[model samples]
Target: MINGISYYPEGRKYTYFLKSEEYKQILDRLEINYENIRLYFSHSISFESKNILEIYLRKCVLDDTLDLFNFFEPILQECFEPETNQYKFEQIVDLVIIEKASNI
Candidate 1:
C-alpha cells in the first residue's frame, strides 16, 4: 500500500516551443486555424519559444504523481504510421522551468 505523497507537486512556470519538420511545415496552417494543434490544452502554445508552456498545465497537473523522470507530456500533432501500424512520435521541443535551477 502507498503511504503518502513522495515528491513536490507544485508546477512551476515554463516556456514551450514546437519543433520537428512537420511542425514547421504546418506553422502557417496553425496560425490560420489555431485549434489544429492544441485546442484546449493550451491556447498560448505556439512557435514562440519564449512563451510560458507550463502555464496551462499548472492548473491541472501537479508533480505529486511524478517520479525522477516523470513529467507532464505535452500534446503534439498525431501522425498515423501504416508501416509500423502505430502512431508516430518524436521530440517536439524542449521545455525550461522558470523557477528551477536547471531543467531535468
Candidate 2:
C-alpha cells in the first residue's frame, strides 16, 4: 500500500482512497499483468467552503495554460455551491502497482 499527503495552493488538502478492484481495472485496460496494486492519499480541506474550493480550482486553471483551464472548467461547473456556513471537502488520489514475475 502507498500513503502520502498532498498539499495544494491556498493550503487546501484532501485524503484519497483507491480500491484493489479499481487498480485491477486500470491494469486490465492497459494490458498490464500485475501481481498486486495499492494506493492512498491524504489532504486537508475539511474547513474549506464550497466557494473557497471553487476559487481555488479556478485559480489553478487561470494561472495555467488553456489546457489546464479546460481540464478543470467542467469540474468547477459540476461542483455544488455550499450553503452559507457549510464546508466542502476533497479526497486524494494514490496508486501503486506490482508487476508479475516472469519465469527465469
Candidate 3:
C-alpha cells in the first residue's frame, strides 16, 4: 500500500497502456493522489537482456490512477542488483488502474 493507501494497478494487462503517454499524463488519467503518491528510485530491475529488466511491486493497491514513479521507485532503490550488460535502455509500457468513486 502506497502511503498507507491501498493502491495498485488494476490489472497487469492495463499496465501496457500506462506507458503510452508522458509520466504526468498517466498520473492525470489515474487521478491518483499525487500528494500521497510518493516517488522513490529504489525499485529494482533485472537485466534479462542488454535492454531488459524485470520489475515488481510488493503491495501497491489498484486505484483509478497509478504513478509509474511509484512502481519504478522501489526498483530504483532496492531491487535489481546483478547486471552484466553495460549498455541498456528501458522502454516502460503504460499501466492503468480502474477505481470506482465512493458514494457521497
Specify the highest-lDDT model's number: 2
Residue-level lDDT of model 1, residues 11-101, one tens digit each, is 4324333443455456444443222332222132432322243443344344334332234322322222345443332322323222322
Show model 1 residue runs off by greater than 4 Å: 1-42, 64-70, 77-104
Colliding pairs, model 2? 13-43, 13-44, 14-43, 14-44, 15-92, 16-92
- Encode model 2's per-residue lDDT on 10-102: one tens digit a residue: 222332345667877877777776665333433223234545554655553344333432544444333334443333334434445557635
**Every candidate's lDDT:** 0.33, 0.43, 0.38
Candidate 2: list runs displaced more than 4 Å. 1-63, 67-71, 84-94
For candidate 3, the per-residue lDDT at 21 reads 43
Question: Clashing residue pairs, candidate 1?
Answer: none
lDDT of 2: 0.43
Error of 1 at 93 (Å): 28
Clashes of each: 0, 6, 27
Clashes of 1: 0
